[model samples]
Target chain A: FRKRQPSVASLIQGIRDGDKTALSRAITLVESKNKTHLVQANQIIEACIADKKNTLRIGITGVPGVGKSTFIEVLGKYLTNQGKKVAVLAVDPTSSLSKGSILGDKTRMEVLVRDENAFIRPSPSEDSLGGVARKTRESIILCEAAHFDVILIETVGVGQSETAVHGMVDFFLLLKLAGAGDELQGIKRGIMEMTDTIVINKADGKNKQAANLAKIEFTRALHFYPPKENGWVPKVLQCSALENEGISEVWQTILNFKDATADAIYDKRKYQNKFWLLQTIEDNLKMQFYEDTAIQQQLEQLTTLVMNAKVSPFVAAEQLLALHQKKLK
Target chain B: FRKRQPSVASLIQGIRDGDKTALSRAITLVESKNKTHLVQANQIIEACIADKKNTLRIGITGVPGVGKSTFIEVLGKYLTNQGKKVAVLAVDPTSSLSKGSILGDKTRMEVLVRDENAFIRPSPSEDSLGGVARKTRESIILCEAAHFDVILIETVGVGQSETAVHGMVDFFLLLKLAGAGDELQGIKRGIMEMTDTIVINKADGKNKQAANLAKIEFTRALHFYPPKENGWVPKVLQCSALENEGISEVWQTILNFKDATADAIYDKRKYQNKFWLLQTIEDNLKMQFYEDTAIQQQLEQLTTLVMNAKVSPFVAAEQLLALHQKKLK
Candidate 1:
């Protein structure tokens, strides 16, 4: 299959016609780092987005030990059973740590793995975090083109990748353990404020009471937080993925959120779209400046001087920027 | 004074010789909007920073009615009595709002006003926040050149100006009222993380007990926050500027922070200096791009398309950037 490469036209057609193989191939093409493949990948992406379907994009995140896979499995199976096509994609930028930890154990997702309507893919490794994020964002278009009604993007909540995931998703769900004290330290400071919902997992046996206590604490804490721009108050609830309890309620909550903020969510997506454009321009401008040989040399010496307070950062930056502009002119 | 323009060499010499008039004039030059004065201002700044002294730069912020002026006046008089020369500068970008609210009332700071070793300047009116921040940061150098041992920058705690102040200051002190609920609403979130010390003011009269309770709550909350990069935990304390109480202890706490993180603080300043240089370059590049007439025309059209989702932001940005780059080449 690698030897007989399919054309971009056929690939787009297959994706529109709901060919799973074409969808997988398109994602692989986007994940490829080869120069030639990049050109073709962008072309395919452009075509896919032209006829893009509106899919529900949900981002799920939690620390390593917080039962993310178990929850995703239960949720994915539940959705598939309701005749909804689900695609599970991972955006683990720290690919080294979560290489085999997520989605590798097929038995963990036993019920969903056997279902024809479900698709699961591991995170793309061997790329920069930006690269991974860009690929994952592009892959969402391909997944939707293949008629996936629901797209769940899973990311490890320990690193900077959560911000990237948050930028691309419609609804952000933070999974937590019963004991919020120690585990909360692993999460970043502003993560809670960005969260749309907080789910306390492992609510069975002795942990049930602790989970209930956590729900109350989180609810009270969130009340003190400034309201999000969309006016959706973040909800906190407990679930035992192991017992498959409270699963439907979580789904209902999500539906309610969508209904309540239906008008505002479109505005949010438009904002995200425009934000990515500006972000790309900013990143590219910085890249261009740093790649210049003259600027890089001045930067090294200026960095030392600024560090020692021999010169102010503002003056040093002005000098460096002037040099770059002169070279450009 | 505005009619007689001083030579850059004379201003530099006067600042080095501890002349306050020269220092104030230098600050005015730096704040000038005239194109001709900009070149001279840069030259004067270059000279001032060449032999800049390490002054203790402290940033103070709080919402309206938090007794910011009273606290500063008490703190300023206390420092000057201990044989330290102090300079108080305001970084209020919204000068319109705080014109008569802060320091404008001479009776509020009667003691500090009569002190020979103190200097107080209002915020520069009719300038952008960036413009105000730049001028205030430059003014710090001028103050230090005149051998001021301590510099206190005042800013309202409501907007983006706090982050700018945080970028330029060595230690950040947040002034809060005893009423945590109403006062907290005025202060933005994520700000407490940036503070080095949280000072609860107006702790006299009926507010004393409430102040102590608020202190305990803040201390407990800080414990959950991530430790700062320099390993210094943010301290929360109650003070009664009205009664001139806890003034010495607050100074003692500041000295202790200086002693404990002496080496790390120097490194942090250097990092800040270098950070500003990069930031200046980034801002300038964006400004230049936006200023181009052709690109501005393209940007307006692309913005509407991106916002309406008629075109993807990535693609729209690519088109706009390509147009600018083509014109540049």
Candidate 2:
């Protein structure tokens, strides 16, 4: 038989005392699908709201083979060395299909996993991107309440995950690999606009010259973009995660960014909170509307008719909504 | 005394017989908020669904002062000269605020407006983008039923209207002017990814060299983007709308694109129909939920709390949702 779960009061007390086990359990509760667990999770979260600490949330993303794991591990170690308690989490929507391809193995971040001041959690391999993002967001609160001073959220550069992660973090860093002649081709549209900094990874050995060239190219390209709303010009830096060089400079850049945009950070977080509030409500509303059995049955037929141009989409949408409202009544 | 409105069947018959007056009246019905008018509009649209004709819907967007009006007028005249009936529509969401800044004055397209084979409609200066887009989409069906062979949808490049217009059209074109140093600066992110062709307008007199240079730069930039899923490579061309030069070449480029992406166009429209169906339903759901007085009142208070970090956004969202559901029940 499983041991009796701790009460909400004990969990809150443990989290305040910086108990890792309590933090992990709280995150599990947030990720749980069981209704009662969710209730308890909300209660703990409510209790921890007043415990907000001075925290910095950074989001890092790169395409596969960009050494995200090594970069994250090195960065986490650097933060911990500076007496900062660090928490590393991930938001990969495809993790369920890929069986947690990112951060799934503890061996990926061997040194950081063993660091006492570092807390690492793999991507939650369940639900949609909304669900995964919500869980990671709630876990940030739990981590901060447990006194983690820095949070690193990592995501793959593919798909819409970068947008989701960008919405939640204070600074967005993009990792890139130097290529022969198509360095900018791998960068997705709108991503350059979101990036606060671009770190060209694996810049050691024979790739050093190409990495330097990429840095100059990105810097010039960045000049064409208008300055960010916070008045911070994005920077491009070169790093070798495997060799653990240039890690300190990356941290220094983040520090300068924080100092430069202190007021903006406060306002940005507030705006992000409001965004998530509305986003969560909208996601829930859509989920409830789509999960209805009657609406689902009619939707399939209406979709086919719409595809065949036999019915206007607006009219079909009205019919589906009318059916849903009638059932609700 | 108000005149009696034509019946739906009579209106459909008139539209089928290529009566512009009937088409205009039908489009007015589609844009109306009156319950009865909407019912009649749906009936007319349903009756016209089987009337899908061989047509091409082209979306044209450019920044203000890019000579969009001149370009469209010349293009419309060209298509009409080729024995193709052309209908022009606008989808400016900001029209409500800017007093229909785009296509507001018919004098802008004076020449084409007088052509019997051409029809031009200013944007409906009311409602949100979704509402405006819905009206324009329904109007497309009405135009097709009237046997218009080519539909030109115009929008300004300032906002999300390009995306909304992109969803409804067969080919997307971006019109640009030769700028001093910031030619690419005016091009918004994600817009280039959607563009099937870019036309450098006003390529006459002293601007001819600059326009050609811009075309070459755009062509090189377009090559970096991976080929579209439809296997069509985007092209950049120069045009002088004032001189009416290269207008035929632009039309020929469109024809080539049409021949190359025939199968893709069929699948794309089907996909677009399904997307709009779900998008409309989702938009409607959010509208109904947000329009609640209780939700509005509570939302302001919850927003402050969430912004202050005194309450988690997820929890606050849940509270608001619970309240909304309770009222609905």
Candidate 3:
């Protein structure tokens, strides 16, 4: 059996049979290192992509130790308890820097990890600004093929550079603690304006009062935010991930959000897919544009000229374009 | 006189002698359309950059309608009254969409605009991430050459991207509102950690308690922040920008920050300058690399091949690199 190489068709069939190992292996094919696997991966993806319509894709991010894993573990368990299969994909962006994840997140999410109705996959947000989207999106399809009803994407909060996940996900959830309201001053308003919902995590204990006060303040603050074009309002929720308080209510709010904007959700997903396609093409073009060989010498010389003040940067750019144009002809 | 065709040396001399018109013209000269002025511009920059390290560079940002203009006006007046010359560069980023500056921040800064010890310039953040560095860097040297003691860079508070100004400034001040503490959940935490201080604006009137409460919350939150590697500790202070309350204190905090970090400021500047230099080189290289005809066609063809699964992105990248290496020879 080991002698028979795994094929994309077989992988897809395994996923259809609800094989967890196959789902994991299919994800690997999607994120494969071998060039030969790309064709098979693409084919399997096209075939196994079942109607991923009912699934809720939520991106949960917070500064480290802000209870992302704990919240997901509790929330995943809650959703699974309600007769839904929950899939959790926790991505560690810091892994790319440190070579292997802190690996602490999985341990924190022990309950969810062990649940028969839940599937947990912790991925590495390898050195891409579109962090985890390529792998995560493909992984979501595999989970859907395996009949998981809901998907939760967990990303280690990137501080300010969060657009990568936000642009891809359906619902973007930001978790924050009480007492640091002023820290918001340093964050960009664009990111705030883009958030779908913001959760005040760790809302129990002595900080309970501060958390309640924060919830009220955030509600008023949400009023100032321009309504998202989808006509869905971003709600503020207070949750004690440790105590599992308000967990079901939080899930209820998400369902309410889905029911309120079902039509728009599909439309948004279509647009988001289109955006990723174009974006990937554009990014590749930019990468290729800069890493070409023929112009390497000319580019180096141009930089030297500009750096030495012998020419303007604009002129250098123009000259390079002119040379490139001539060479292309 | 209108047709004087003023040489750049004469322009620099005039700017050095406190000629407001000349200073404005110099900014345009650096931010020139003709491109030829760049060579002359750098000569002047090199000349003026010498013996001009006394200016305090303050970066100020806040969400729209958060009193950034009003606070700048008040702070500008306060600095000027202390017998210190000030220059205000109000960056208008939203103009990219509107195609014109809204509110004309300089006029809103009435007191500072009228003060003889102050100079105010409001320009669109056209190509913000690019243009700000070009014009503002030169403007700072020009201001320093003219003996201005403080240079306040008022940038539109667009989250995630606002850090561009933070890197270029000596002190990064994030402005917030008193009761509007809830929106903090939506903003990023990295910017907060990068900030030198958080100033709560509009702190007077019915919002006093909210402002005090915000201060207490901020003090507690700052504890979670990792101390700045530059040996700077971010502080939270309450100020009423509308009433001009705490304006002097705000300026004093900046002064104290400089004094405390005096020994490392030069090293920081050197590192920052080198960073920008490498950044510029890398950005330019990227643009030129794809434009090179030697592999442009091949790259595009490879893209389709990859898209169709004939090749993987990694292989495409490797092939492109090989071509680049050959071209290097």
Candidate 4:
């Protein structure tokens, strides 16, 4: 509502005062479409990017169940118990309107959400990739700038497109159930190839045997996976999110993965950020060049011709390119 | 190797005799792009199209080590035992240098390969979707024309792109290890959403509890999945491919699914076929038109200017369209 304001002054002051709410709001300001805010947001982020690079970014995903919230709660508690400042950034892909999540995720992580050393923020997917709401990547930078040691991102569907999460994180953990029957049929290889760690949940009580069996099967399966450049093979473990058993073990695995992959982390993060930058540029060019006003007039005609097989989308694209060149000349 | 040259009179007589080898040679001739050979090949397949649509197309996919081969052997035997014909068309995605999978895959399924009632052919992926070996889809039609009652497609890799199997099959069954820790995570929502039935494999020995728990978890997960318009909700079952237990049950499940989905079958198949037809046409047009001699010069120049950002790709596209429009006018 208050549009005419000095955002730069507020941003610097909030950051200096170490305000998480201010940092989140500032990130929202950066993602806002208003042209002026884009420039300002970019300025603030650019100033903080150096400090942000040191934060450990982790991407956690699975199907709706598999207890994502409970795991995060246990993981968050464990991390904070070790005196680490942790931020849990969750993107619930189920529409905010539809009560679609496996659990009322935010409400379920009550203990961790209330922790002083832990910060939990849940964003509605707004129909984005697996519902990890938009701009959460940018928000991670802000969180890192604000000094959250471990930043966890959770999404809904983990299809090939879900590799976007893989691109943004330093370590990728795949959470599995105690026994995923036909474990082979349940998962696709491409997703498995990207995983840094695979944790099987619900390993407590009667489920222990199944969980251990799953672990053995997964370890065997992991062998076929090509070794990572840093020579770190994904580790498989069993845990019960409800019982809080083996949560610490999962934490230890992550720590080991970090230690093993530490030297490559900065380079990996930088390269990933660059990849995003180029991808965004390509996307914007496609939209602005091909989808906008000047092209719209010609596109309709091209579509009709192509639909009738009189001309092709290719020829039309070529011709359009020629026109664009002429105009620029 | 001796060239088996046939006399012109005998070749004509052989066609009249309905010789299967002649028919297969004719089909292969049609699929070849050898300019002269293509003319003959096209004639044969075109003549055979009427006979091709009768095959019962089945698609089978699972992650590695899901006993996909063992299950296929059992199903092939069952079909053969019932006095029906079966063929397994496996597509392996590993490079041609993997000592030609066509040879290795057949060796892996010794029983089915040796059976006179069945045919087993393993093909190299030729580097495409779902490890697509060239013309395998077309080959299904050929197999059907040649009187195979069931055409089973076994694809390697259980990942996102493997959904290509879904489009081509009457039934899509996913095999999984009974209890693998990463089952839930590895399976992903996309895979869960696409599968018609999930059969948890290796349900023997100590993994029984794991299998039961997996069934429970999968059942719960399936509840969240919106029922297919075909009224077929993917069923979860336990099976030991090695023990041959539940093989017949799996077949019955497939039959049940087919009978139930029969009503929606026509529309789904029609939509899928139409999609591929239009998609192929679009790809053809794109490659044909842009690569045309006339469009080539202008496209290169425009690409350079646009790539340098000296002129926007849009503006360059616009100029090309104008020139093409002028030519048409």
Tens digit of per-residue lDDT, candidate 3, span A115-165: 888888867446764445566666776788799888888776554346666
Residues B15-66 of candidate 2 have per-residue lDDT tens digits of 9999999999999999888999999999999999768678999999998889
The sequence of per-residue lDDT tens digits that candidate 3 reaches over residues B155-174 is 76554346667766788998
Q: Give the higher-DockQ candidate: 1 or 4.
A: 1
How close is every model to the real structure, measured as TM-score? Answer: 0.91, 0.95, 0.66, 0.52
lDDT of all predictions, in order shown?
0.81, 0.90, 0.70, 0.65
CAPRI class of candidate 2: medium
After the best TM-score superposition of candidate 3, give how far the Cα of residue B96 lies from its true spot, in angstroms.
Answer: 7.4
Over A209-291, each residue of candidate 4 has an lDDT whose tens digit, in order, gives 88888888778766544457777879998889899899988888888987888778876765565455434433333443554
How many pairs of residues in model 2 come into backbone collision? 0
> In candidate 2, which residue pairs get closer than 3 Å at backbone N, Cα or C atoms, i.e. clash?
none
Q: Tens-digit lDDT track for model 2 on A69-131?
A: 999999999889988999999999999788855887999999999999999998887768988
**Better structure of 3 and 4 per lDDT:** 3
- Model 3 chain B: weakest 10-residue lDDT segment is B306-315
Candidate 1 per-residue lDDT, tens place, A235-283, comes to 9988989999989988888888889999677777778878877887777
The deviation in Å at residue A120 for candidate 2 is 1.1
- Model 1 pairs whose backbones collide: none
Chain B, candidate 1: TM? 0.93
Q: What is residue A29's positional error in candidate 2, in angstroms?
A: 2.0
Tell me the docking grade of candidate 4.
incorrect
- For this target, which candidate reaches the highest DockQ against the unseen true structure? 2
Q: Who is ahead in TM-score, 3 or 4?
A: 3
What are the RMSDs of all candidates, in order? 3.2, 2.4, 7.7, 10.9
Candidate 2 Cα outliers beyond 4 Å, as residue runs: A1-4, A98-101, A186-189, A220-227, B1-4, B98-101, B220-227
